[model samples]
Target: MHVTDACGRGGATPPSRWDPAEPDPVAGLLATARRRLGMDLCWFSRLIGGAQVIEACDGDAAAFGVHPGSTVHHPGPHRSHALAERPLPVVGRIRPEAVTSGTATEATGTAATGVEATGGPLAGRPEVGSYIGVPVTLADGRPYGMLCCLSRDADVAMPARKTRSLALLAEVLSASISDRRSGGEYREAAWWRIWRLIDSGGPTMVFQPVFDLPSLDCVGAEALARFPPGSGGAERWFADAAAVGLGPALELSAIRSALRAFTCLPPEFGLGVNASPATILSGRLADAIADIPADRLVVEVTEGDRVEDYPSVRCALGVLRREGVRIAVDDVGAGYASLHHLVQLQPDFIKMDQCLTRRIDADPARRALAAALVHFAQETGSLVLAEGVETARELGVLIGTGVHQAQGHYLAPPGPLPLPASANRTRPPDTA
Candidate 1:
């Protein structure tokens, strides 16, 4: 029996913040209600998989032999009212007179803490006599569970106002649960879609040619991924895959698809594939590129995010390098993490971020940075490749800045290999 909040996902509550030690919003509400109503305990129990499990609680749970995750038996009638689909009257055994004078229903013979045959407020703990519970319902009018408060004393007066407040609290909990469940469902759907895509051999691969600025000759092509139409951009698809823990598999699939182009591309032209630190560290990337000619393969390590462990990534790349594959640090000058990566990875190529090249002809700041990166690359025995060059002016600026190579819409939009003649400046005449 998994104890979750009013929502169906497996957790006592949605995290209140980054810190797990902090009390969650559901727990805070339970505490406030418990103190205001003067109850010995207040807890939210979610009916998950047909078991009544405590998800969040406030007050001395141990005293009543219950805690979060404790599965308890509920009287059939009371439970029906608590989880009713409509706004029925609140159910309780608040006072001696209000107590349902009957032998408490027998408990289901399930293995659970604090569960017993006596269906009292605290189930096994017969000492709890004052109990008030309101149904928590989802937006779809389905019963989620109950918001309940109880006390050890039978004659405790649960005022009308307090009962109303409890109902309101339940309503708030219901809304939160509904919203969370909806988000969870959306993510699950997205995950399944990406999973199926990967299962079907990953996103379509397209190669955008990267050219040497001076010669304007086809040097290599960067492999870009293309998901199905209306599936959003390539970045979004990869993000969705990453969120669902399938990032590495999807990326490797893309790499494998890109490798297929090696059979079509001229031996002189190299192929650049994008990879994150995570995929590189997976230890499969080296194997993926092993069949291709080593010198004609470049792995562009994307710097959209920071790498957690540089030493491990360096070691991983080293393996690929030893086998003749080159490494390029991508999106340089776009962020501090990229700069940090440049220092740590010491890659064979430094690909300038598009932002720095977008309008370098007009922005002196951009030119200065581009020049500085080129100089840095020169000093470090690395080549600087300007990415995303979209105009003649930007291309001229990058060329004048001594960028070794460049790629973007200006160079060529990604398409099938064997570069389009319009984009191909000078292919080796001898190469077939």
Candidate 2:
């Protein structure tokens, strides 16, 4: 929360913000409701494959002209301002207004977290469920949004208990976001609720200074998202996100948070962000990058967990490429299967993972791996990036291998990055 509330004694509610929604009624009610609905997207648009859906979205999805949902997205008049006009940042949940119907039938065991939208570019988009969002706030309220579950099913109306529960959640959500007492407020807190811990003016960002190997000049910046509050460290906060099924949500929030900080960066530098394959598959990536200048951004696909669907991941990456976002295969040599993904993706940049970069001057095996990755990148006309260059000797070896870029503590540790006074004026040596 960005607001400054005067006279403390704010209050407490036992983290029990609100009760969760109850299940919806049985199948008969759902079927009847779904049948009553008129003209859905599939019915309105001509039958085309996912490609056609993509074509429609690319052509005109925003106008709601491209495709209609199985049910109307805005059933009646636009009622968003009601929930949206608050100060809390809506994180894990959807907007209250977007609530359509809740299910009492059975839990599909799927999460409410945003997912890869399906079909075209619009497919696998984050937030597929019916929902609405609005921000709530305390005094110095930094307005946030709410993600409320409108309806459990696309066609059904949510039960009264569910709506009431969601509404209760909305209220607590507002308070949780607005309650920014001190650094220790987030320990053991719900991960999504951790948004309240967002530092002043929202979350802060540090741009890892990236040096072009041959030129040894600052050519780009990798945006590293870090929260200032320590109620829980980065690992804890990140862990919470995964627990609440909001890994992608947090990642997207971090990217947007990074972008807000990016405005201060020197315009010439390309901005890079660590992106996960999970997010790419969910599909709102294009929507996320739609506002950013494609020429100035590089989305490094850092694989965590595992690459479940390479084809889908590749397809999403291809779209990003088509849109001009540079792709980088991060941690190239750390994973045994990395090379295969690298070869398949044919990324614009291949970052030598820190495992291989650390102590490379003394390790023959690491050096060999580095050499092989560099050779592959060069052969494919892709630039090589060497991260974790913590020593002069290590840097020397990287320069010798003809690696294209380097970043690490020796050059710069991840800090509130704007090229500190020591770094802003300094330049990398011209190894070429």
In lDDT terms, which candidate is top?
A: 1
Can you write out model 2's per-residue Cα lDDT over 1-432, one digit (the tens) per residue?
223212121212223332234222212322332233221121111112211112111112342222433222211111232234322221123332322221111112222222112323233233233432222333354333222222222423423444344345445544544453321234226633654543223345677889877556877678876766655566666666654445665666677777664567677788888777777776767877877778788988876557767888899988888899999988887785566669777899998889999888889998888889888877898998998887777888998988989888777777665654233325455343
lDDT of 1 by residue, 347-387 (tens): 99999999998888899999999999989988999999999
What do the candidate models score in CA lDDT, each in turn? 0.74, 0.55
**Model 1 lDDT-worst window of ten:** 106-115
CA displacement after TM-score superposition, residue 189 of candidate 2 (Å): 3.6
TM-score of 2: 0.53
Candidate 2 clashes: the total is 51
TM-score of 1: 0.83
lDDT (Cα, 0-100) at 230 in candidate 2: 56
